[model samples]
Target: MADRLSQVSGHLTNSYGRGLLAGEVAIITGMCWRSWSGIGRSAALLFAKEGAKVVVSDLDEKKAQIVVDEIKAAGGDAIAVGGDVGADDFPQKVVDAATKKYGKINHIVNNAGFTFDRMLHTTPDDAWDVIQKIHVRAPFRLIRAAAPHMRFKVRRENRSVINVSSISGLHGNVGQANYATAKAAVVGLTKTVAKEWGGFGVRANTVAFGFVKTRLTQAKEEGASIEINGKKVALGIPGAKDDPNAQYPHIPLNRGASPDEAAAGILFLASPLASFVTGHTLEVTGGQGI
Candidate 1:
């Protein structure tokens, strides 16, 4: 069974909901349709169900709106703000919209990014730059843009910011030199922000994922693709030469994580449950590193 937090699972509409995030305003980047949708979308929806008003960002405006619509249909309040997170101006636009719509920003999830796999000596400069821009630079800019808004609410509420990393970044992986570098950079950035923002009561953390079931994990032969910065890029789990499912059997859990299951750790970091936690990297790998 999938984790309840991963599913709607009586949490959103159920009377049993903890309302863990009651009265919070959240901004989740990369939450929409297509490749970047999995974890970001689940986090957005889960946050809303916990009583947050969300501002969701995606590269595709229409795709962003689709997720926004789903939130509203479920009786939650949300809005779509779409743009390339790698762009210099896009982060500010997303932060501005969230504050304008919700009166303040309390949570930010810098989950917008994609993998560009290649060996170090063979990777193209474009691939290296694109991966870095999306994974490292984008999150840095978004957090920088959202921090000021969150500070204003620091005394009133425990503001939180969460960045998404991956197992490839943690233990390192073949054919992912670019992703591994950027994600490792994210660990440093997350810890730095935690110290800088802690005095203001803002908690910053990174949720490093193992293998979550998403288009990124699909076998290359599945022919999955995503449009990023207007270029079609291959989307897959990186090491799959044959069966994509081959990687899962090696996982300690003996299964890949559901999107919602991956998101559950993120929500905890973003919610009051992790009020004292910051500068921490919560590995959601089902003991993959062990």
Candidate 2:
């Protein structure tokens, strides 16, 4: 089933031409993960297929370069920028990279983040702070860094800012108190950006995803882990039954989304197709929490 889905996604991507996002420049962060299932990587590839020059950012420099190579091999324009978004200077560096390569930024997809899940009672202070720093503070800083480019004095075209959120933010999740609070703040930040930048023809929105089959959602027993501050932080759900069908019964589709599927939602918001859509949270869950 996964292979078939990949084939279909590849076909549709190849079908895209210089139409929806032609002549646009975009910066998409978090474009790399151990597996090729990062939503940001998918978004970068999809955006490039639609004719957008992409600036792909990720903490893993080598992995990010792989995605950049893939884009260029597909006859798409892209450059890899490696940095930690949690760093104070990294956001400006991303903005600089985009402007330096593409001349200007038209779209910003704040998709660089991770999860450090723990129940409220067990959550550590540093865990909560780091989650907010990565998920909420990073986006805020990136937008602020790109404001001069996007919030132009005399705008020439429609610009977009798509912030990635989660259903956990909208409807709290177990063992995700830190994640939920940070994601909820993301919605407020996006709405404020829309309100402040609407007159400049800049649209800001959020994509609230539910379950997506990425490293973050893979079973913890798989041993996929990310290092944070010298400590190994494990990724994925604990005690997952290893059955997609049995795992997501609450979702109407009874399955988690593929990264490519989630990227489609980000593509729509960044494309001209959603010219008038702003300050909205397009939930990409399979009818979960409805």
Clash pairs of candidate 2? none
What would the per-residue lDDT of candidate 2 be over residues 39-102, giving only the tens digit for each residue? 9999999998988899998898787889989999999999999989999999889898888878
CA lDDT of every candidate: 0.82, 0.88
lDDT for model 2 comes to 0.88
- At residue 2, candidate 2 shows an lDDT of 91
lDDT of 1 at 22: 75
Q: Work out candidate 1's RMSD over C-alphas.
A: 6.3
Per-model TM values vs. the true structure: 0.88, 0.92
Which candidate has the top score in lDDT?
Answer: 2
Best by TM-score: 2
